[model samples]
Target: MKLHAADILVIFWLGFLTVSTVKGSVASQIAPRSSCVDLSTQQLDIRNLAKYEMQHIPVKAVMFITRRGIKICVQPDLKWVQNAIKFLDKRPVTRRPTTKPKSKPKPKPKGN
Candidate 1:
């Protein structure tokens, strides 16, 4: 059986997409998911933020990162909002370390 360039290209593209899709799904599954999200950054004060479903919206999700840098996403309901709040309040918001901002180099004195 003879395979043309198009056939090979199609197979390669399909395989690449399949692998990427699988990888994405696996990565998502590996990520932590729950009702209460623990955040690393103290920047967001979850205490005041409203995370539950709003008047019109049926679902609302909260995203935060752990001290260990694990990101978590959760939807609010009756059962877990309080628990999540407590968990966040207890842990000090350890902000993600920021890299030094690159300063613009002073205009090089007109090259001699």
Candidate 2:
């Protein structure tokens, strides 16, 4: 039996939809979830912190990322949290050193 052009087009469209749906679910699962459910009141050393991000979903807090790749959630209005933010902002930016090209020496003058 011969398949009509319309039938082939319909099959292609259904396959495309199924693939996109599966891809969307996988992507959502792989995405990082940053909502803060619990917050800590302990004071953290500003030196150990690498940076911070404000978390507004599920709770209002500050998420401090440590140099060791740990995330600490703290209340935004806390004195220590505010101080840590200021300290991080004032810290100098670190940059990688760039190599410079070597200059060639000029040719010696020929004997007269």
lDDT of each: 0.56, 0.92
TM-score for each candidate, following the candidate numbering: 0.29, 0.62
Best by lDDT: 2
Candidate 2, run of 10 with poorest lDDT: 27-36
Q: Best candidate, TM-score-wise?
A: 2
lDDT of 1 by residue, 1-112 (tens): 9999999999999999999999999888865334443323234435444332212123355554544554454544434555766666676656778999999989978877
**Cα lDDT tens digits for candidate 2, 6-76:** 99999999999999999999888865577688999899999899999998878999999999989999999
TM value for model 2: 0.62
Candidate 1 — what's its lDDT?
A: 0.56
Each prediction's number of clashing residue pairs: 1, 0
- Name the lDDT value of residue 80 in candidate 1: 57
